[model samples]
Target: MKRRAHLAGLLALPMFWLIGIYIFSLVMLLVTAFWTTDPFTSKVKPGFTLRNFEQLVANPAYLSTAVRTLVIALAVTVLCMLISVPLGIFMAKIAKPWLRALLAVAITLPLWAGYLVKILAMRVTFTDAGFFNWALAPFGITGPSFSITTVVLTLTYLWLPYMAVPVYTAIRQLPANLFDASADLGAGAWRTIRTIVLPLIKPAIIAGSIFTFSLSLGDYIAAKFVGGSTQMIGSIIASNINLNPPIAAAFAVVPIAFVVIYLLSVQRTGALERM
Candidate 1:
């Protein structure tokens, strides 16, 4: 009884905050999604209606923006996976102890810097006379103008550490003897990675992907800075929030639904258990 009481005491404050504040806000937002706002008065009038959702479904621009955001999110995840896997392997399996430590620091350094600063830096880099174009001039390759390609590249840059760190940790946790055993059986390095390492690291990759996908899905600031006129679901929500909150709420639910569905899919793959 005493131990149970103590445990409950420890959980009391956080539970109150989560349930009372966080969950309560989410409930309010979802409830508001079914509500209507008065156009003449510009005020939220609470009543049940599915019209907001219908509008979301019917709007061609909204549909395109949602599709565009989804594509960007998937691209970010794929790009992160491609970059992180081999880099993770090198950091975990090949680097000397000092080199590993240095690499870890290098990987984590960007996260310590402000996100806005990094985005701004990328903005400068992609400009016509910026370092990217200047460096590529000799190769006759033009820098990507402010476009979807730039958005993908910037997002991938921002989220790479999130994927790489977790993957590196997973690879490092793997037993060294597994590699030795695979090699003893005459499996080459590529074969061992495909048959052995890939299976074991699948969970960690999925874990990292959760962060990359969800963040990319909701990002508005990066898109605004580098996307030119391109708009994401978040940008649309921000635009409509004060004027038509119900519509914003309705749109807000899309990414949440996408994330929930994604998590469910990943759950079925059993990758979450590894995390």
Candidate 2:
């Protein structure tokens, strides 16, 4: 009883924050989605209506934007996975101790900077007169310069740490004997990674993917600075937030739904439990 009481006390603050702030905001967003806006005044009113959701499907631009956002999110996740796996393996198994520590710091360095600062850095890097274009000018090549590709690159840069850290940690936790045994069994590096390392680190990969996907899905800032003419789901939500809040709320639910579906899909693999 005493231990249970202590545990409850320890959980009290976080539980309250979860229920009171996070859940409460989500509930409010759902409720707001069903509300209506006055056409003339452009003010939100408490009422139930499906018009907001209808607008989502009825408008082709919104549909395209949602699809584009999904693609970007998926691209970022895949890029992070591809980069993190090799990096994690090297850092955990191959790199010397000092080099490993330096690599770890490099992986997490971006996270230490402010979000907007990093986005601006990418903005500067890809701009016409920025480092990217200037460096490639001698070869008569050009940078992508404020496009969907830049958005994906920026997002991958922003979220790579989330994916890399966990993957590296998981790989580090793996037993060294597994690699030795795989080698003894005539497994090459690629075969050993495909058959052994990947399966064992599946949970960490899924966990990292969740962060990269969800963050990229809901992000408009990166798209704003580096995407030029690209419009994402979050862009629509931000635009309508003041003039037609119900629409914004409804659009906000799109990313939430995608994330929930993703979680459900991954849950079957027991990844969520491992996380």
- Which is the leading candidate under TM-score? 1
Tens digits of lDDT, candidate 2, 1-275: 99999999999999999999999999999999999999999999999999999999999998899999999999999999999999999999999999999998898888889999999999999988999999999999999999999999999999999999999999999999999999999999999999999999999999999999999999999999999999999899999998999999999988999999999999988888978
In order of appearance, the predictions have TM-scores of 0.97, 0.96
Residue 146 lDDT (model 1) = 90
User: By lDDT, who's the top model here?
Assistant: 2
Q: Residue 114, candidate 1: how far off, in angstroms?
A: 0.9
Poorest 10 consecutive residues by lDDT, candidate 1: 266-275
Instruction: List residue ranges in candidate 2 displaced over 4 A.
Output: 1-8
Q: Model 1 reaches what TM-score against the true structure? A: 0.97
Model 2 gets an lDDT of 0.96
